[model samples]
Structures are given as C-alpha cells and as structure tokens.
Target: VVYQRIGNIPGVRSASIVSGRNFFSGSGSSYGLGFVLLDSFEERDADSLSSEAITQKMFMRTAGIADAKIIFFTPPSVPGFGASDGFEVRLLDRTARDIRDLDQVATEFSGVLSQRPEISYANNSFSTTFPQLMMEVNIPKAKEAGVPVSDILSAMQGYIGGFYAADFSRFGKQFRVFVQSKPEDREEADDLNSIFVRNTQGEMAPISEFVSLERTYGPQTIGRFNLFNNVTLNGGAAPGYSSGDAIRAIQEEAEKLPADYDIAFSGITREEIASAGQAGIIFALSILFVYFFLAAQYESYVLPLAVLLSLPIGVAGAYASISLMGLENNIYFQIALIMLLGLLAKNAILIVEFARQRRQHGLSITEAAVEGARVRLRPILMTSFAFILGLLPLALANGVGAVGNRSIGTGAVGGLLVGTVIGVFVIPVLFIVFQYLQEKVSSKPAVIHSNETKPNV
Candidate 1:
C-alpha cells in the first residue's frame, strides 16, 4: 500500500518495497523497507518539484498509516559512512529498563524531536509489538522429578527454537541438520504440555509440569550501544537547514531526556561531528605555509602580509556567490575556497614581486607600485578570465555529480572574478604600504664622519 501510494506521488519515478535488508538499509531490521526514486533534474526543475519538496508531500500523504512508522531520507552522500544522510542517534538506556518501557521512551523521544523546527522527521524502528511467549522454569520441581534442568531446556529448545543436531559431508559439500517439531505441534501455548524430557532413571516426564508459559509482547530483536540497551533514531534536517543544525538541535533536546538516558551518534553523524571545524584549521595551515613560502622567496618576513591580506576579498566573494546560489558550504565549496586562495595569492605575488624589483632599482614606492600594476595588468586579466571561462561548464553542470561540480566551479569563478578585478587595484596599494614600511624598518641611522668626530672629542 505504501509503495503504491508513494509511487503515485508527483516527481517520484518509482517506489519499491524490498523484502529483506540490504547493505544500505542502515542498522536495523528489514521490515517495511521501501525505496523511492525521484525524477531526474530536468523533470524537477522548479523549487516546488525538488526532492525535498516531493519528500514532504510523500510524508503528508503517508501520514495516515497509523500501523507503521515511515521515514524518508536521502541516501548518504558518501556510502559506508551511514545508512542515510542526516543524523543517526542512539538513545541509550543505562538504567536497564524493561523493553516495553524502552519502547515508550523511544516513541516519546521521536515525538518530541519531530516537533523541533530543525528536524524534518525523527522516528525509531525499535518496537515491542511482536507477539511473544514467556517461559519460567521450576528448577526445584525438575530436580525432584529426576528430570535435569538441562533436559527440560533441551526439550523446549528442540521443539520451539529448533536445535542444531549434527553436520554431514556430501559430494564436496557440507550440510548441517536441525531437529524441530512439526509446525502444528509447536503452534500453540498448550503444545508445551505435549513436550517430554528423559529423566535420570530412564523415565519420561512431561516438561509442562516443570515450566510455565504466558503470552507477552516484545521486540523480535534488541540493540545495544556502549554496553547499554539503546534505540536508534534516524532523521534528516528540515528544509533550509544543514545537517550540523540538525545535530545541534538533537543535542539541545537530549538534555530534556530523563536521567540515565543519553544520546550517541553513529555513522555519518559521528564522522560529521569528528570533522567539524577542521576546515578552519586546515585553511589556517594553508595560509601559514603560503606565508612562509613567500617570505623565503622575497627574503623579507614583512612583505608576505601584503599578499595574504588581499586573500579575503576572493574568499568573501566565493562564499557570497555560493550563498546567493543556494548552495551549502560543503566539501567541494571548501576545496574551491582553497584553490581560490592559491590563485588569488599568485595574482598578488605578480604585482608585489614586480613592485619590489622596481623599488630596488631606485624608483619611489608609489612609482614602483603604479608601474607594477600597469605591467602585470594584461597577464592577470588574461589568466584570470581564462580560468573563469574554463569553469563555466561546471557552474552550469547537470546530471550526475552536478551539485559538487557547480559548487566547485561557481566558487572558483566568483572568487577569481572579484580577486582579479578588485585585487588588481588593491594589490598595488597594499604593496606600496607594506613595501614602504619594510624599507623604513630595514634602514639604518645615518653616521657622522670619524675625522670630524675625533677633533670634537
């Protein structure tokens, strides 16, 4: 029913209901596993027809299914990092609560999280709805009847759980044998009365006399994390929000959980948290390396500042362009920023290096600066414009990997455009200021002649 309904949704290319869990199913049972494929970018060209928008529609349309919990998420940007893109949280129960209580808490947590503005949806697969049979052993009675506790357990295991009996080798193959009662023989609670175990005296004793059975409800499987029972909640960020925002929102709301309850991240969320803020450190290191390299080339520690200071103009333009285009500051964008940093620095170097040479040749700082800008203008424009034109296809990329391509291309183009145009004007002025300061600091005080000084003394 869900497959049919979701398939009918506009922009959904197809919807499939898979019977078993596959590699990409994440960390849970395969029950209710469904996959949806959306139309290609060409078909869904409008904001209203986007994947997020279509997913929202599906959510609303399927909200009427009260018997099953359905969650929709994009595939993880990087495979093996997680089951899906967004946040993977494990709600830990450190107090050793009953399975039913755990289910209640998980449901409540999901409900609370769903209300948060940052989260698009939050749901857990941990359920206690499967019918179960609970059994209690009467150890003393079994011992008195000469029917050992192991014998009783063996009888039940063989009849209900199916026992592994033996293995046999065939024509280049091996097979294991299992012992179990007929399906009908083990279908009801009363079947326990029919089960019999051998006593020590070689007598047959009914196992029901040494055990009790009761109907119950519990999950088919339980999960553990950090040595404690846990329920996993899978969710994604709301529209206009990033995964980082979703993670922060989850952490804030987790504080409201009861004592002994905690939250931990897994898969991509763990990776995201671990890698957070690393970009800034890396960018700083890149700048440091460039500074030292420039210092070595010019043999002046002070002159590097003139080149580094002009970098922000390019970086700022990169970020502004991406933001205006509705792209995130993702890895590709960061990569572009780094590349732009190098290109911008190179442009500045062309002007600064030339200006410094002119200054050494006896020209005034202002004259040297103006001449540098004039001489380097043609090459700077030609190289910068050529690079920008080369990235045009990527900025307007379509189909597979388009988002990443656009991110890299748009950022590089925007940064170079701003850097080359404004940087051409700014670099010379910066060189003039820093070069003047460099000369002043390096100059020594004038000395009087020794012949005149000796007579005065």
Candidate 2:
C-alpha cells in the first residue's frame, strides 16, 4: 500500500517497500519506503518537485499509520552510519526502564514534528508493531502436579532439538539423546501445543493445557544510546527551508516534551552541532597563530597589530557574499572563512611589510606608507585574482559536495577581492598610525637618514 501510494506521486520514478520481517532482522528495527526520483526532478517549481511535495504533505492521510517518513537516498553504504539525507530526531527516555513508555513518548513527539510544515516525513523509529506471544511458566501449578519447571522447558526445547538423555561411548566419544517427533508434525504453533508433557502422575498432558500464550504488540528491536532507550523521528526539510531552520522548528516543538524525554540529533545534524562548537576553537587558533607569526616576522608587536587590523574587512566581505548567495553558515562555510583568514592576513602582510622596509630606508612616514600600498597593489590584485579564478570552477561545478565547494569558492572570491580592494586604502592609514606609535614608544627618531631630499612617493 505504501509503495503504491508513493509510486503514484509524479516525481517518483519507482517506489519499493521492505517489509518488517526483512527490515527488522534483529540488529535494526525500522522499515521504510525507498523512492527513486525522476531524472528531471528539480526542487523549485517543477512537476517532479511539486509531486514529491504533495505526496509528503498528504502522507499522514493514510489510514492505520502511526508515523511516516520520506527521504532521498544515494548509496555506497557506510558502516556504523545512518543512511539518511534528512534529519533524524532521537527521543531518549530517561526514566522509562523499558520500551513501553518510551515508545508512547516517541509516538507523541513524532506527532508534534509531523504537524510542522517546515519538515517532511516526520516518523518514529518504532514503525513496525508486531504481535508477540509471551509464555509464562505456571510454577505453582507445576509444583502441585509434581512436575518441575525445568521439565516443562526441557519439553519445549525437545521440539526444537531432541532432549539430551544420556551419553553413549563410541569411537572414543560419548553421546546420548532420544527424541520422538516428526519435523512436519511440529511445523506450526498448533503442533507444539498438541505435544504432551509428563506430570507427577507419569501421564501425558497437553502442552497447551499447561502453558498460556497471550498476544500483544511489541517492537521488534530496541535502540539504545548512552544506556537510554532511543526512538528516532526522521524526516527531511521542506522546500525553501534549510536543515538548520528545520532543526530550530524541532527544538521549538521539543518544549512540549514530557520530563523523562530527552532529545538528541543524529547524522548530519549531529555533525553540524559538533562542527559549530569546534569552529570557535578553530577560529581562535587561526587568529592566535597568525598574530604570533606576524609578530615574529616583523620582530615587533606593534607592526603586527596593523596587519591584524586589515582582517575584519575581508572576513566581513566573505560573510556578505555567503549571505547574498543564500548559503547557510554551515561547517563548510565556517571552514571557508578560516581559510580566507590566512589569505586576508597575507594581503595585509604584503603592504605592512613593504612600508616598514621603506621606513627603514629613510623615507618619511607618509612616503613609506604610500610607497608600500602603491607598490604592492599589483601583486596583491594579481595573486588574489588568480586565486579567485582558480575557485571559479569549483563554484560552478555540480553534483556531490557542490554546495560545500561553492560555499568555499564563493567566500574566498569575495573575501580576497573585497578585502584587498578595501585594504589598499585602509592599510596605509593603519600603517602610519601604528608606525607613529612605534616611533613614540621607542627612543628612535622618525627621521632615520641624513639630509637627503625627499623623493615623491
């Protein structure tokens, strides 16, 4: 039914459903429909995209479904990794000892996510509910009848495997067992019930008469993370929505959760959170490294300060470009920013280092600063444009990792061009200001050379 309904949708080239029997093979406990989208499918205003959107919107309309999910898949399966392009919401039950209450809470949370328009296919991990027949040992009754509970269990194991009776010596090995039952006769549950067990009276009694089987629905598998039972709510972002926006929506819905329920994200969403935390550390480390390196190269702390001043403009330009391109401030974007930090520092270094050399050569402060900026302009532009052009292919390329490629390429282009253009004017002023400070703090006079006529910068 699921496959047929999804197959009916316009963009779906084909839809195949895997049953719980096949899907929940002990290690995993989830079943879903895999969709193959048409080649012509496009996310914006296309027939395939429209069809997929409508299908997900109306998914809950199906009868007898607790939760449903739809996501894109392209394979080269990675071990110990989830196979989802969409976000996965894990509901952790702290107080619940078993899956009973945990599953109920999971279902309720799934319902909340399903109601949100920004997310699609909000499904609980406990999707397959199968009837399990539990067997209880009637210990008191067995004692009264003079039949031990072990005897009853032994009888059951015998049906599956002949009960061990005694050891017989043969070929230097001892083995002994006797069992009576045809394979065909014990093929079904009814056949097992028909088998007899010996009571204290030494009389055969029907197995069904001693054991009671009650049918109840239970999850086929239990998933645990950090020793707490977990149920995942899986889904993809809606059209025109970023994964971050979808996650924020999920966080909003999490407010209504019961006290025992804790939330955790998985897959790319979890990686994103981890990356964001590390980004701050990476940024700090990059700045410290650049500042100290410049300090060492110039052999003075004050001149390095001037080099650092040019960094903000380049970083700002990078961010502005990303915003204009509608790219999220994801890990890829942050990584690009870190890389551009170096490039921006390089541009400032060229100007500041050149001007400091001119100052040492007995030029006036203005002449040195002007000469520094004017001379290095071509080299800075040349190198920056060369790099920008090199990244152009990455920005324009399509397919896997294209988003990340473009994010880095476009950011580099913006940061290099905008920062260099602005830094040319700004660095000279910063150089003069910082140089005056250097002159004031040190005992050296500003005029380092003899009475030579000043040449035009």
How far is each candidate from the true structure, as Cα RMSD in Å?
6.1, 6.7
Q: Candidate 1: worst 10 consecutive residues by lDDT?
A: 444-453
| Model 2 per-residue lDDT tens digits across residues 61-142 | 3544545443443331233345556676688888766677787777878787877888865766574365566777777877
Residue by residue across 170-241, what tens digits does model 1's lDDT show? 998999999999999988877878988888999887788888987887786788889999998889888766
- Candidate 1, TM-score vs. the true structure? 0.85
Give all candidates' CA lDDT scores. 0.86, 0.73
| Top TM-score hit | 1
**Candidate 2: pairs in clash:** none
Deviating ranges (above 4 Å) for candidate 1? 18-30, 37-50, 97-104, 128-130, 163-185, 193-195, 201-206, 444-457
State residue 71's C-alpha deviation in candidate 2, in Å: 5.7
